[model samples]
Target chain A: DQQVKQNSPSLSVQEGRISILNCDYTNSMFDYFLWYKKYPAEGPTFLISISSIKDKNEDGRFTVFLNKSAKHLSLHIVPSQPGDSAVYFCAARAEGDSSYKLIFGSGTRLLVRP
Target chain B: NAGVTQTPKFRILKIGQSMTLQCTQDMNHNYMYWYRQDPGMGLKLIYYSVGAGITDKGEVPNGYNVSRSTTEDFPLRLELAAPSQTSVYFCASGAVSEQYFGPGTRLTVT
Candidate 1:
């Protein structure tokens, strides 16, 4: 069973436009959500995160919005840059797990055209 | 600080062969994990260790074994390699929230 899902396999946007990536989860026990950006042949790097208690979290040009009721979350990048083109993965952490194990989505390949 | 490191960036093994993938962390993190990523798929957890001498299975642990003899090292072993085992493996370690990942090891089983 895939606890987390990213329906879109890929996305394309202009460098000066906005890019939005969406994710959904079936498990309500997840309280923390994180987004990681990965380049080809490189490890993923942390981008932004949001707690269940908050509806939105922003870090520079990146913003993540969480909707507990809909069991969904999204990552938004304003004025996307060419450097923002990469695979974006959404992960969730369940509650009461000391291991902090995360369930990750299939990931979306984002293409920002210059 | 070389947060996390994995050895043998690329390897090729024949069917029924056995090999080990090495992972190390200099962050002194108490938590470490191993994951595998297949083509067009997300990463699936293989095994994890809370600390030295402690380990647990994750979503998919079959055909694989792991050991945590020390806080800095967590190695994953494939007893009998199969074509289905071909994928990129990742090692990660962290304290609480975020996990730092290694560059990854691409393994091919023929």
Candidate 2:
């Protein structure tokens, strides 16, 4: 089962525009969520994350909003840059899971058009 | 710090061949994991280790083997190569909340 889902396979936004990527999870037991950015031939890099108790977390131009009631989370990049263009994956972790097993979504390819 | 490092950035194996994908981390973190990513698909966990000598299988573990002999190394071994195994493999280390990934190793089984 795909515990985490990113329905949108691809997205495009003009440079300097707001870019939003959404993710949903079916397992309510997950308490930690993370977003990773990946470039071709490279491993994924952690972008930002938010705990289930928090509704929102922000770091500079990147902000993550978590809506526990809906089991949905979104990553928003304001003033999106061409450098931000890459595949983004959303991952979730269950509470009290010692192994740190993460369930990742298929990923969304975001292109920041100049 | 190297954080996480993977060897043999790229490899091509023939059917029935076997090879090991090496992974090591420098952060001294106790948790390490192996994941494989296929085209148009997200990374699927193959195995993970909580510490030295403690290992467990993840979502997709068949045809793959892992051993954590030290806190820093977690290597994945593929005994028999198959075309279905062609993909990119990633090794990550860190807490469950955040993970650091290696550059990745690309393997193609012909």
Candidate 3:
């Protein structure tokens, strides 16, 4: 079963515009969510994260919004730059006590057109 | 800290041949994982180890074997390589919330 899903396979946004990527999860047990960005030939790097307790978390130009009731989350990048072009993956963790197994989505390849 | 490191960034094997992919972490993390990614597909977990001497199978574990003799190293073995096993493999390490991934090893079976 696909616990996490990213319906959009690719996205394109003009540079200096906002880029939004969405993700959904079927498992309500997940409490922690994270977004990772990957460049060609490099490993994925953590971008931002949010806990179930908060609705939104922001770090500079990157912000993550979590809607627990909807079992959805999104990553927003303001003034998107060409350097931000890469594959973005959304992962969720359902911690059953101390054990938290991460479930990841297929990923969305974003292109910031200049 | 070189969070996670994988050896032989690229390799090619013939059908019926066998090989092992090496992975090491320097962060002293207790949790380690192996995942494979196919073209246009997300990563699928092959195996994972909570600590040395304790290993568990993940979503796709067939045609693969793993050993965790020491916390610093976790290696994956392919008994009889097949064309179907061609893909990019990733090794990750983490202690709690975040996972650090290696540069990935791309393998092809001819």
Tens digits of lDDT, candidate 2, B1-110: 67899999999999999999999999999999999999988999999988999999999899999999899999999999999999999999988778899999999999
After the best TM-score superposition of candidate 1, give how far the Cα of residue A52 lies from its true spot, in angstroms.
Answer: 0.6
lDDT of 3: 0.91
- What residue runs in model 1 are displaced by over 4 Å at the alpha carbon? none
lDDT of 1: 0.92
Please write out the lDDT profile of model 1 over residues B3-81, one tens digit for every residue: 8999989999999999999999999899999999999888888999999999999888999999999999999999999
**Model 1, residue pairs in steric clash:** none
What is the per-residue lDDT of model 3 for residues B1-110, given as tens digits with 9 covering 90 to 100?
A: 67899988999999999999999999888899999988887778898999999998888899999999999999999999999999999999994368899999999999
Error of 1 at B101 (Å): 0.2
Residue A32 in candidate 1, Cα distance off native in Å: 0.7
lDDT of 2 at B26: 94
TM-score between candidate 1 and the true structure: 0.97
State the lDDT of candidate 1 residue by residue for A1-114, as single tens digits: 899999999999999999999999999889899998999988777888899999999999999999999999999999899999999999998889633688889999999999
Best by lDDT: 2
Individual DockQ of the candidates? Answer: 0.65, 0.80, 0.59
TM per candidate, chain B? 0.97, 0.98, 0.97
Give candidate 1's chain B TM-score: 0.97
Candidate 3: segments with Cα more than 4 A from true spot: none
Model 2 in CAPRI terms: which quality?
Answer: high
Cα lDDT tens digits, model 2, A90-113, are 999887753378999999999999
Off by over 4 Å in 2: A97-99
Higher TM-score: candidate 2 or 3? Answer: 2
